[model samples]
Every structure is written in structure tokens, then in C-alpha cells.
Target: MAEVTYYTEEGLAKLREELQYLKTEGRTKIANAIAEARDKGDLSENAEYDAAKEAQGLHEAKIAKLETVLSTARIIDESNLDTSKVLALSIVKIKNVKNGAVMTYQLVSETEADFKSGKISVKSPIAQGLLGLKVGDIATVSVPAGEMNLEILEISR
Candidate 1:
């Protein structure tokens, strides 16, 4: 069975957009390149043809990868997500037990993770540790920096 991947609405939209582009403009560009290469020389002796074929191979590989990704996608409903505990699509506020540093992060899909916006992938160590934790609950996570304890303060969205 194909594994199901959870994604937010925005993340799904982005994937759909990418798939559309690959099917349309991306394929067209690759086809054009192949055609140009074919026109330039003897089929077996042409480096341009070889390069174009390689590019086409790479392009199709990317398309197939995207297809697999889209096939497993399951978009999460933000409105139904509970705020009482950490979960996918939840914005959580946590305080570091050792350093007293506070931070907020929205647990999202890998596609939706944007550090600039404080969004983290649910698969990430910190998010994995925070999952199922409620306010006043403490979670321990290990990173390259070492293991740290974080206290959940709030959950929303």
C-alpha cells in the first residue's frame, strides 16, 4: 500500500501547481530541447543529442517523483484540527526548560515547512516530540545540538 502523506491545503495547492507546470510548460521545454538536438546532428555521434536525452531522463524522473508524492498526499482540514494538544496543523508555543527561550511553530507538512514563517515539518524531531503534547506538558527532543526539554504553553489553529 502506498503510504499516506499529510499536507495542509496550501501545500497540496503547491504540489498541484507543480504537477500542472511539469505536464505543460516543463514537458514542452524538454521536447523543444530534444527537437533542437535532433536537428543538429547524426543521431549516434551528437553530444547535443546525448545531453538532451539525459535532460529528458532527468525531467521524467522528477515528474515521476512528483506523481508519487501527489498520489500519497492527504490534505489536512485546518478547521477541524484540535487546539487542545499538539497535532498536524497546530500552532504550538513552547518554552525551553534549560534556556528559558520561548518559541512558536506551526507543525506542518514537509512541503509546507517554512522556517522564515516559523512553520516546521511534523516529521522533524521537535515536532515529533511535541505531537500529542498538551499545554503544561513537557517533551524531550534530541537534535544535533543534543537533547533538550521543552514545555508546551499553548496550542491553536
Candidate 2:
């Protein structure tokens, strides 16, 4: 079964743009590279041609994967999201119970996750633990480092 991924409108638009680019400019660039490589050598012993072919395969695979992801994606309207509890697309503020260090993150789909931007994937351990939790709820999340307790401070769309 294909997994359905939820994406914000902006994220979905970005994905569509990327898919269009891959189908056009990206494919053209790869084709040109392959053609140039093919013209440079004998078919039997051309390393450049081989490399170009491999690159083309990889590029095509990426396009196919992106297409599948786009096909199964559902755009989420942020304005309609509930802010009463942590959920996908919810911006959550959490404080470490042990150290009192507070952090904020937006739970997003894997493709839209950018740790540096404080957007975490819904599949992430922390997000998973926080999902469906309300403010003042304590969640114990298991990370590679160790398990830590976090208190939900706020939830917003």
C-alpha cells in the first residue's frame, strides 16, 4: 500500500515545482550528459558513458520516487488545524523536564522536515511521542542518546 503523506500548501507547491523541474531541466541535463559521454568513447570500454548511464538511472529513480510521493500526498490547510493538541502540522513548544530547556518544532512530513528550521518529521521519535498530546502533558521520547521527558508547553496551528 502506498503511504499517504500530509503536506502544507506551501510544501506541496514546492514539491510540484521540483517535480516539474525534474521532468524538464533535470532530464534534459542528464540526457545531454549521456549524449556527450556516448560521443566521446567506444561502447565496449567507455567509463564516462558507463558513469553517465548510472547517473541517468539514479536520476530516473529519483523522479519516479518523487512522482509516487506526490501522487500520494494530501495537502493540509493550516487554517483548519486544531491547536488544542499536538498533531501533524502543529507547532509545538516543549520544555525538557530535567533541564528546563525549551524548544519549538513544527511537525511536518518527511520531505518537508528541516531540522535547522525547527520542522521535524512526524515519524521522528520526538514527534511521535508528542502527537495527540495537549499542553501540560508530559511525554517520554526515546532518542538515540537516551529517553527524556518533555512537557508540552504550547500547541499552535
Candidate 3:
């Protein structure tokens, strides 16, 4: 069985929209490419036809993957979440123990995680170390550089 994934409503909507596009406009485009390639000449020696078929296969595979994701995706209810400790969708403010630098990040599902937007994947090393931690708790996380300590300053929805 596929692992169940948690997502915000916005994230799930975006996935649904992408799946719809892949099934509609995306499928139409691939079909047109296949038809145009087929019209070019004999199938046995047509590189364009082969490429189009390959593209179609890849596209179908993507559609299947998206379908599976949608099937297992569940939207989390922020209102019911506990704010006393870090959890998925919780916005956490943390301070570097060694440098005193502060950073805030929202722990989100992998698909919704965007570093530029201050959202980090819950599966990320830092997030993993911070999970279930409360304000004033220190988390020791391992990264590519080395291990660092981060102090949780605040937690919010």
C-alpha cells in the first residue's frame, strides 16, 4: 500500500487541477503529436513516431502517479491541531544556538514545501528533529555541514 500523505486544502486543490490538466489538455497534446508523427511516414523507421510514443508513455506514467497521490492524500484540519508542540502545518520560530540567528518555517508536506516561502518539508532533517518539541526546547539536527542546535522560540498554526 502507498503511504498516506497529509496536505493542506490548497495543496490538494493544486494537485487535482494538475491531474485534470494532464488528463485533458495534456492528453490532447500528446495525441496530436502522435498523430502528426504517424502522418510523417512509415512507422518502422520514424524517429519522430518513436519519440512521440515514448513521450506518451512517460505522460501516462505521470498521470498514474498523480492519481495515486490524489487517492492517498488527506487534508489536515488546522483548527484541531495542538499548538503546544511542533506538528505538521505548525509555524515555528527557531534560533540558532551557536550564532543566535533566527528563522521561521512552517512544517508542511513535501509537495507543499517551498524554501523561498519559509515552508519546509516535515521529512527534512531539521523538521524531523524539531517535531514534538515545544517552546524553549532545543533540537539537535544533522545536516550536510554538521550537527547544529536550534532552540524553539515559538509555535503557532
Q: Against the true structure, candidate 2 has what lDDT?
A: 0.94
TM-score of 3: 0.97
Better of 2 and 3 by lDDT: 3
Better of 1 and 3 by lDDT: 3
CA deviation > 4 Å runs, candidate 3: none
lDDT of 1: 0.92
Residue-pair clashes per prediction, in order, are 0, 0, 0
Model 1 over residues 89-152: C-alpha lDDT tens digits?
A: 8999999999999999999888789999999999999999999999999999999899999999
Candidate 1 — number of clashing residue pairs?
0
Error of 3 at 22 (Å): 0.5
User: What are the candidates' C-alpha RMSDs?
Assistant: 1.5, 0.8, 0.9
- TM-scores for all candidates: the values are 0.91, 0.97, 0.97
Best lDDT among the predictions, by candidate number: 3
Candidate 2 wrong stretches, greater than 4 Å: none
lDDT of 3 by residue, 9-123 (tens): 9989999999999999999999999999999999999999999999999999999999999999999999999999999999999999999999999999898999999999999
Per-residue C-alpha lDDT of model 2 across residues 1-157, encoded as one tens digit per residue? 7999999989999999998999999999989998998898687899888888998899899999999999999988788778898989999999999999999999999999999999999999999999999999999999999999999999988
Candidate 3 residue 80 C-alpha distance from true site, Å:
0.5
